[model samples]
Target chain A: MCGIVGLFLKKPELRPQLGAHLQTMLVGMTDRGPDSAGIAVYHRPVEANQCKLTTFHANPDYPWRKLGGQLAEALNAEVDVEIKANHAVITVGAAEGSARAWITRSHPEVRIMGYGQLMEVYKDMGLPADVARRYSLEGMEGSHAIGHTRMATESAVTTEHSHPFTAAPDMCLVHNGSLSNHNNLRKWLRRRGLEFETDNDSEVAARYFAYRLGEGATLAEALEAGLRDLDGFYTFTMGTRDGFAVLRDGIACKPAVLAETDDWVAMASEFRSLANLPGVEKANIWEPEPAVVYTWSLQEAA
Target chain B: MNTIDLSKTPVRELNQRLHDLTPDTNERLWRITNLKGEHALAVGLTVPIEVEIDGHVGYYCAGMNKEAKVVITGHCGVGVAENIMSGEVRVKGNASQAAAASGHGGLVVIEGDASARCGISMKGVDIVVGGSVGHMSAFMGQSGSLVVCGDAGQSLGDSIYEARLYVQGSVESLGSDCIEKEMTPHHLAKLERLLSRAGIEADPRRFRRYGSARRLYSFHVDQAEQY
Candidate 1:
């Protein structure tokens, strides 16, 4: 059992309250999944030539400043790092590929949680409320956010095993159900030169979308492809730089409730996560149908 | 008349209070407010009382009800009236999956659409949906009457038994051993009574009736491929 929640702000004025609203939503799902929790927040974009990397180290007191200095010298570019708990948001004036290569080679212990211009991913093995508090999720601001509380049905309960797995830049996925064909799919993806970070089934789903998108498939098209290829009872809430999407399998045993008001669009595994949102009483709430892809983006909202 | 605010009172306490009520209890009319999609609200009741929930609810809102009439003013989650023996559970808005699963008796009404498995394994309950129902509704239903005013999704009544299904709109597909039967006069009368009981006004003659073909009841060698 797992819980997924996503919020996309249609109105720009509600951007500052995104994390607070999402925090409440994630905490409400604690009963559904208490093993671990993860969140991905998409704030405003960085400079055109810069990319931000959310890096995690097991030791909370890891020398992030020394790593920043070395990264600056190695890349021959200005590097900025901000520490939060055991994670650091590293910004550099280079492409994601070069930065990732340098960090993996020089700082082997540091794990890159996510890399994009606007997104920062944080996850840990703990209760949802505790994880939220550890990262101060309520005070953060973003245009969109995706959260997952996992019960760890098919994998170990570790920070790496937690969800909101990012494969391609500016994209992440949180899944609520297990996949039966992940081992075969993972092998198929590995043959395509896709490097996997964990053996978790949900990670395979995330990378599958990334693989499809890499091959020039649109978000909806990639999801439709998933409907045909991915074999599972999954309710996935995925995030991109511009928006987020919700998809349920054909059987759709995993529940998903979508609510959209004039200000925001929210999707969760159950209505309890959405019950406390502002203007929820007037929101248009319904369950996403089976094998259907529902996407909400600021581009379309404009 | 009694009013219980669920925000201040826990669901377990409220259900216990309702369970303690006798058949002739003076507090027959009850109102619940601040219903923030909580689960198992007003469940396991045996007294003849009326419960009115003022907001959306989570799973199993009024399950195992015997003689109560529970009404939700907003949407409901999965299994709204699961395993109900008697009484009525009504949802004023849309309902999630398995709306009245394994219900043995009484009536369940959804004024809006019902998601997949609307009346799965229903024993004897009557479910009336003012709108459509999702896939595999009434799958393996033993005995009951399911009335849908709108469309029905795929595989309606896969392995149905004595239960009867009536749909006013189109059916995407029918399950194995479940075929469209002629809408007889007796079925029209029963549909009329069910619609009127749920306060929905629909022409009974426009609905189509479906039931089990009874082919799978005895299992013959020639029908092995269908299985």
Candidate 2:
């Protein structure tokens, strides 16, 4: 039994309260999932050429500044690394591919959590409250955020095995149910040049969406493809650079509730996570139908 | 009327207070405020009292209810009145999955839509939904009646037995061994009574009845290929 929560602010003026609202939403699901927690916040986008890479290392005292200096010299671009516990946001004045290739070639020990112009991913093995406090989630600001509390049904309870699994830049996926055909699907995706970071079933789904997006399918199209291709009882809430999307399997045994107000839209495994939101009493709430792909994008609003 | 604010008082204390009331107690009316989606609120009551919740609730709001009448003014989480024995459980808003699962005897009414498995494995309770219900509803139901004013999702009443299903709207697909039967006058009368009890206004003649075909009751050599 895992719990998934996502909040997308429809109004830009409410962006500063994104993490605070998300913290409450995540902590409310502690009883549903207490093993591990993770979050991906989309905020503070970089330039068209530059990118931001969120990296995680086991050791808290890892020399992030030294790597920043070395990367600056190696790539001939200004690199900035801001440390937060075992995670760091490394901003480089270069393209995402170059920065990613440089880190993979030179610093193989550092695990890149995610890379994009506007997204920062943070995950750890602890209670949702502790992880939120460790990352100072309430004080952070973002336009949208997605969080997951995992009970670890099909994978180990490690930082690497947590949800909000990232693949393409500014894209992450969180799952609430297990997949029966992930082992075979993982093999099928591996044959198509999609590299996996963990042996977790949810990571396979994340990379599957990435593979679809890489093939030029729109977000909703990719999820529609998942309805026919993927097999399991799953309720998935995915986040990308433009917005977020939610889908449930054909059987739809897993629970998911979506609520929307004039200012924001939120989804969780239950209504308890959304009960405390502002104007939630008047928000339009409904359960997403089975095999239906629901997408919300800020670009469309723009 | 007694008012208990859940924001200041814990759910445990509220339930304990309700449990302490005797059958002949004067406090027959309860008003619960500031629910904030709390779970296991006012469950396992055997007395004939009335409970009114003012907000949304989490899972198992009125499980194992006996003679109490629990009412929720807002949406509810999963298993709203699961395994209810006797009395009535009403939700003015929508309900999540497994709304009245395995209930024995009582009336469960949802004024709005109900999610997946609305009356799964129901024993003797009668459920009336004002709006639609999601997939796999009333799967393996036994010895009760289910009424849906709106549509029903896929696989309604899979492997059902003895339970009666009446729907006024479209049924996406019926499950194995469950088929629509001729709606007789007796069924229309029973459905009219059920709708009246739930305070819903729908024509009983427009409804359809479905139940078990009794083919899968026992193993037979003629159906060996299906096995």
- The TM-score of the first chain in every model comes to 0.98, 0.98
CAPRI class assigned to model 1: medium
lDDT of 2 by residue, A1-302 (tens): 99999999999889899999999999989988899999999999998889999999999999999999999998899898999999999999999999999889999999999999999999998899999999999988888999999887665788898879999999999999988899999999989878877888888899999999999999999999998888887999999998999999987889899998889999999889998999998887888888999999998655
Q: Summing lDDT over every window of 10 consecutive residues in candidate 2 chain B, give the lowest-scoring window.
A: B217-226
Q: Which has the greatest DockQ? A: 1
Clashes of each: 0, 0
lDDT of 1 by residue, A151-262 (tens): 8776688899998999999999999998999999999999999998888898999999999999999999999999999998899999999989999999999999988888
TM-score of chain B of each: 0.96, 0.95
Q: By TM-score, who's the top model here?
A: 1
lDDT per residue as tens, model 2, B151-215? 99999999998899999999999998899999998888899999999999999999999999988
What's the TM for model 1?
Answer: 0.97
